[model samples]
Target: MISTEYVVSEQPFTVRRTVKWGQCDPAGVVYTVVFAEYVISTAELFYGCLFGQGPQQAKDKYQFGTPTRGLTFDFRKSLRPDQQFDTEVRVGRIGTSTYQLLMHARDMEGDTVFTACLTPICIVRGQRESIPIPEYFKEKLKAHQTSDAP
Candidate 1:
């Protein structure tokens, strides 16, 4: 069974989002791919809030880049256009050169619409070589790490 223990974070970063017309299909339901986009954007926002800099600025100033190495999502409910939702992002796991982000999007009723896990590797921007996560960055991520128990 997939572990649900990782879903509970000590400190989660949340972003409020509204589904737009362009993100929906003819059926008025959000396109599946758009969920992935939401996760990516929320990850950027998480980093921005943690470091006080945007993705590009982080790369330019730190010479390090975080590129998604893997992503997986579970859809529970269809989302409609103009519906408001909240995406909660937490640090799932941190490794030597990679970190996993757990993201869950919930509708107004607090029901989970979808969940995603993103594995991003820290790389040297120019060389594209995996590198150890910076101490400062790792510490910041630790603050968001999920708890062991549900």
Candidate 2:
């Protein structure tokens, strides 16, 4: 038998952006890839709060930041550029040196327009390989998980 470890918890996150002129397709719907950027941006905000500053600012201090290892998205509905959407980010899993950030984008009517998740690896400064999550940062992330739990 194999044992598995994957924890999932949902948290609220909001995003408001008008579809750019070039972000829409012939159908005038937002491109699927656009949601991924929103998801990443929202997740970065959460990470920023976890650290002492924004994601880039935190990276400036530590000389490193979590880098996206993978991204997956499922498009459920269509969105127009005139519409703004809010996203919810959930921690789907936390591994020895990586975490999955799940995001769902919803319109004003609370309909899901898109869903995405990003797997980011924790790495050392100026290095390309993975590393164990720092003790201080792990504690901080755990606290964030606990506080957002229902």
Candidate 3:
């Protein structure tokens, strides 16, 4: 299992989720696709905390949206229905128009069950063209950067 103590120690933005029956495969482990959805949802919550606004609000107010450029995850342990875990999201890297978000989900015992790296690009809402990250948003993301992510 991946050690997540350092990541959690900093108290990064987190979201707790319980694996639901519908999210599991016949073998009772969480379906792989569900993990991606969890990451996306957690990222939304992370952005909400960082910007004081959710995804929709950011688009409406700033005319910019963060769309996933790429995503990758490693499943360290299986999650069964009813299992509760907390996903912690931290800034990994901030680029001109893209930022890398790292996330790890730990079980009640604090063992990492899954880890993900997601690249999201800031884009002009209507044109969907990449743009430099807003200065204020960049500052907030930098504040959450951690060097201990796995």
Candidate 4:
């Protein structure tokens, strides 16, 4: 119920979303847990941008998988119901078996709401063992990589 309609952009890899009633708590502020959902959903859509298809579909077609290795976030502002914000996605560090997806959420006034980093480790399908990141995936991420991040 956390996900509402979101707009995705490939040029700079951004997702725009509007907070909904379902996403907020009784106190009229977004639930703390919802931030995690926002991050994961944005990452899924980012995969869609990279693969030119749905994220799960791409994973199935490629016969590979990315499992979350780590996730961290820093909240700068509170989001209330009916608020709209932009979650800009930037490709961060690329490692042998893991990569970082940096997501920065900014409010309508251009103020930062939150910043997150999602590190997903690559692995062979159906296996827990790790593998080197595929070249295709690396190249795609590099095309969108950015150096400016705080």
Of 3 and 4, which scores higher on lDDT?
A: 4
Q: Which candidate has the top score in TM-score?
A: 4
Cα lDDT of model 3 by residue, 6-109, tens digit: 11233567788878888999999988998888898888777767767666887669888888999998889999988889888789888899989998888999
**Model 1 regions more than 4 Å off:** 1-11
Across residues 32-129, which tens digit of lDDT does each residue of candidate 2 receive? 77666666767776776567476777776876668889998888988775676667666666679887777777777989888787888888777898
Clashes of 1: 0
How well does model 3 score by local distance difference test? 0.82
lDDT of 1 by residue, 31-123 (tens): 888888888888887888788767679777988999999999999999897788888887887899998998888998999999899999999
Over 4 Å off in model 2, which ranges? 1-11, 144-150
Candidate 1 has what TM-score? 0.89
Per-residue lDDT tens digits of candidate 4, residues 81-150?
9899999999889899998999999999999999999999999989998999989989998898888633
Clashes of each: 0, 0, 0, 0
lDDT of 4: 0.89
Clashing pairs in 2: none
Q: Residue 148 of model 3: what lDDT?
A: 67
What are the models' TM-scores?
A: 0.89, 0.78, 0.88, 0.93
Error of 3 at 123 (Å): 0.5
> Which 10 consecutive positions of candidate 1 have the poorest summed lDDT?
1-10
